[model samples]
Target chain A: MPRLINRHPGRGPALMLGLVPFIVLIFAYLLGSHVRLAANPDDKLLPTPSTLMSTLHTYAAEEDVRSGQVLFWVDTMASLERILIALVLSASIGLAFGLAIGALPVVRAALAPFVAVVSMIPPLAILPILFIVLGLGEVAKIALMTLGIAPVIVRDLALRAAELPSEQLIKAQTLGASSWQLVTRVILPQMWPRLIDSLRLSMGCAWLFLIAAEAIASTEGLGYRIFLVRRYLAMDVILPYVAWITLLAFLMDWALKILRSRAFPWTDMSR
Target chain B: MARVTVKGLWKRYGDTVVLENINLDFADHEFVTIVGASGCGKTTFLRILLGMEQPSKGRLLIDGEPVSPEPGPDRGIVFQRYSLFPHLTVLGNLILGLELRRSRVLGKLFGARRREAIVRAESILEAVGLAGARDRYPAQLSGGMQQRLSIAQSVIGEPRILLLDEPFGALDPGITADMHKLILDLWAANAMTIFMVTHDLKEGFELGTRLLVFDKLRHDPQAPEAYGAKVTYDIPLRRLKNDRERQRLAIVEASGSEPSYAPAG
Candidate 1:
């Protein structure tokens, strides 16, 4: 008699039940678009300023839709490549220094106030300077994402390292564990279950920040496509791209969840 | 094998004395339980024995040599609350000491550390009746099983001396008794020295080889300037081999309750 989650008793129906809200959201959002169109036919359904202003249905059938789709696929690949590069760089930076700072209490205390001060300024505030310094190239995007994500990653890890049980750590020391071994055995293994959750959350934030950064400066990413679509008021073109990006972000989260479950299968999902 | 001897042990946190002139000895393979009411300095005494702290006026000797105020391979501690790592599997939790503490770089690279660690952990877990539950996480285990897992970890490290602070105090009576039996079985098998702090009277009687009830009010001359705790009694478990011992064990059991204190002279 599970009460909170399983309203349905069995698998087949339960799986179907999971899909109901998503199905309903699509139906509802699309229905609202129709109603909005019916109420104001003269009002633009979507933005398509690049080619020409047109109705939602009219632009839905144009080359803009096809062109947008092509742009989407290419830019998605580029964005993905950028994110992977950023992940490696940030993970390296985050882990190397994170472990160092996280492990040492003196280092953490000395740097904590400064770290907190810098975090509040918002990484997005210095985009123009980053653009000037690194140029509006893939390097800047990758660098920005690393800078943006690493601190958060390190901060999370540092706090976790701090939260590590004092007794076990004392026990490890009593057993003659080296510092490296402490990190490898006690820290990382324990860090993983949390690190996975942070990684998943960081993935979403990375996407959001990357898309924003790309939109402001990128000529060829999904953000550029969204910006390009906005010119001609093509709602249908813009809408699907939004839907795809949303769906992809969701999929990445779900996929990462699967990876987490596979990697550390022992942890029960924390609701 | 070290004969851990503490002499005129003095410890204090600021102005409050925790253990004063606490003289005690744990021979190789001796299982001594330090039982007292809470804040009775039993744990502080254990920590001092483990070398996590130094006695202000006393000396701690391992094999009759002074030990550093730091943890070493000779000591293994099992805390009641923080028994196992929440993220690691039972096997992973068990081998952490060996993998991280014993193995060298070559050991890690040759993959010997991992292999040997796993082997040791598996055998340890099996000894504690946790073979079927190797893949289970600490969070997935019941309190009793987790306690067993913790015991395996401490015991598997094969330290010269084991320090446990209220290891079964958190469990229900049924689980606690089961854990006590498991601990007894492990002790019987290994015959290594064990020093545990406990407040459970029945548990102290059930698990201890030698019972030392800390006298929180006993005056110590050397430690008067530092910490000021005293001992009530140190009873040999051999005396409690039968039901008659249980009757004599009344004083050992009663020490856990509030007793009127004489002002230190």
Candidate 2:
């Protein structure tokens, strides 16, 4: 009897295999776009690749008439800056909170339930409150992203810290580590890679909150530009912008993974 | 070197008692081994001695002064598992205590002192036969190597007393033999006062200058918590030089509910 052995593909084959689905989707889109355009050259719904490229060039390569700014670069920079700031703020808060709660029984008993409750409340529901307090500026947008992602990072880190062997804590204590020293030397040193992992896991949710906040109110951002183009049925600009945002997100995720593997190779169980 | 004295020690968790009326004196530079049946409060006793857990009633004294309620450099401990910090390499684990002692900030050992610590750590690693694995993480080492590194880590602190809670309980015979020799060498070389708990009776007899056996003699099913484990025997092995004495002690252990030691010949 013939049997099928579905072994995991190597890097080259895996990459080629990954592109198969995308190639199929593109081929289908191209055929459909061609048919629609053949019927009506004035169709604005499914813009051809050339139309999208030209629109992308105008936004990315050329300067705007009024502001003299490359809108694509400006939007990318604004969105990236907001995300970077939010991620840093949230990760720092999460790591500190998680370390305290996980290491200290009093802190855990006092704040664990409160943190759990806060995490349950969706961040988007409080978007209006954030705007009212912080105004409809970059602060509000970044705050929304931070609020959405920080709690999750906290939960993950706390759980990880709690799961560490009690022996490690005892060993550190026996070595004359004070409570502060124990947390800083033993707990925090071990937690750096896990913190990075928690941040990486929260990145997807961060992007979602970032886009939502920017879409609601922002002068210059990828999300704001996407919403702006949607008003005039500018699918050419909208699709490319969406693609560009996806690319940026994937790159960020890939870079973090590489950093984690390179810097804390011991954390990788597979190795 | 410091003498350890335990007077009227008792430990309880809620309604259930674990250790009851433990009183003993450990001389400086003595190698003491505690052996007992499973769930006989050996580990609980060791934990109390290490200051990781407090006794319900009684106090431990190091030399003439009372031991601190919390763990400190005066006493060090090695557990059967998870003794090494997984994040640190073999050399890093050995130097951690030195680094922490010198630096105010954690994980930031600096300048000439740091280099000195590393050099000392490397020598300790070589002594422990782990020089080749100095750069590897604990997870990268074999179980035997990991235990050796952990022993080095505890010894690096130069603690007056070293507590072991069945540190060789999980290793195979060959590795366990190597560990026993290594531990004995370290103890003699450093002049450390050592206290260890183990389930293996032969191991208890082989390595200990003094052996303490723990057991529960009374069992009341209706009042299960009525009796807790107590030190049944405090035999000084240094004086048991003849087969007659060993046979006498073994016979006494078999016949009586409490451990009895034979008089020194």
Candidate 3:
């Protein structure tokens, strides 16, 4: 008898309800594939589910005749290595620059405007310039990812440090904290959780930059593999590759989120 | 112990004057309570005493010497809120002062030194009745518990002077009485001069050995920034118990007829 808006489901029903859309989409895909396959057996636009699964298995398990390495994992490792290096580099640089810009007036006056200007420049537009200068090597790909996200992380952390309650700074000073001590003892520790949060938010952008760079120049990577097979209209290979990339991105984000909550429990007070 | 002396003190921010031509002397261990209307300079004056702000004119002397320009361990402060670090546990907050003082670069102690600091921190936590909550974060604690921790954080440093700016203003009325008792006990136990600013006049009368009232004795209707608040009433409460009622009545009358008291000059 309750109004639809007021009828809130319990946990089990809510979870089941959340899956309804995914279920509908999958059923629709299967129906479309069957219809397309019944008309023509050589249809490549919508591969049958069985064909898609076999293609995924081949790519994942079979060894390539030329490279002798499992192509899927080799591509995955190549992509992961580039993205992780860029992420680590971005995090460290962001923390240092952010704290410096936020805590000290001199540093802020000098660098805040510069950082703002840098962040405003669309990172993708500079990919050609990066490629020319750093060359079509691993450095260019890593640089692209770092450049795309580091400014954002720096700007976010700088604002966080700047908005720290003035009272806390004064209290720390009264406790005999020097200028350096203020940064390390008070400001630096609080930046860890926020840094992790910034990294989580930056993951998608990092992946985009990685893919774009790899598609343009790399010989071996997830993005390279997808583009390499696209000329033949290989939907089966491309579809599985896209799904694998999504799964990998989801897993990395999930791992970082779990690490943040576990290591910095105080940051999430709602729990 | 520290004896503080103020002479011809003035504070101004550009055209607006906050406090003007104030002077006073506080002996060691005196509990001075300051009361005034909003926008008055009680807080500014306290900041000057804490070395967080500089006087526009004249001097502030502690023990017959000019006070340090920068805040040091000699002075401790507790604001109304945001005084405790959110990232630190209750016990971590207590030993932070000692750690900063002893280990200049790292801001941390190690081995035997670390154990000693923890023991000291535990004793202070026990004193503040936060022993059970030593591992808890500030957000998890109630308002009263947080304020208690703030006070404990300030007192553990063994400062010569303690400045509190409306520390209990955000606490519930039921919890204030307990806070008052805790502060009074701390004041008695530590040989430190105390200055507290409060909006509640009766609280000023109850807790202080001396009461100071800051009110502007001059005003300009056209240019309101022409004048600033001064210490108009300095009542010695402890020595003159018989005169309490009379002084209270005088403050009420003065505040009631504030316009008459503020001359055009």
DockQ by candidate, in order = 0.31, 0.34, 0.39
Candidate 2 residue pairs in clash (backbone atoms < 3 Å): none
RMSD of each: 7.9, 7.3, 7.2
* Candidate with better TM-score, 1 vs 3: 3
Q: In terms of lDDT, which candidate is strongest?
A: 3
User: Candidate 3's error at A113, in angstroms?
Assistant: 1.0
Instruction: State the lDDT of candidate 1 residue by residue for A1-271, as single tens digits.
Output: 5786666548988789899998998687667666776788665673233323233335344334645544545777887888888877777766766676788777888876776676565778877778999998988888778778888877877787888878877877766676666777667776776766777778877887788888888877766667776887756566666766788788878987898888876566321
1 versus 2: better TM-score goes to: 2
Against the true structure, candidate 1 reaches a TM-score of: 0.81
Q: Judged by DockQ, which candidate is best?
A: 3
* Runs in model 1 lying further than 4 Å from the true structure: A1-32, A35-42, A46-69, A269-271, B86-88, B106-126, B175-178, B188-191, B218-228, B239-265
- Second chain TM-score per prediction? 0.82, 0.88, 0.89
The residue ranges of model 3 lying beyond 4 angstroms of the native Cα positions read A1-8, B240-265
| Count of clashes, each model | 16, 0, 0
Please give the lDDT score for candidate 1.
Answer: 0.73
Candidate 3's residue-wise lDDT over B1-265, tens digit each?
7999999999999999999999999999999999999889999999999888999998999999999998888999999999888899888888898899999999999999999999998988887778888998887878788888999999989999999999999977765766776787799899999999999998898779999999999999999998999999999888664476456546555544312111111
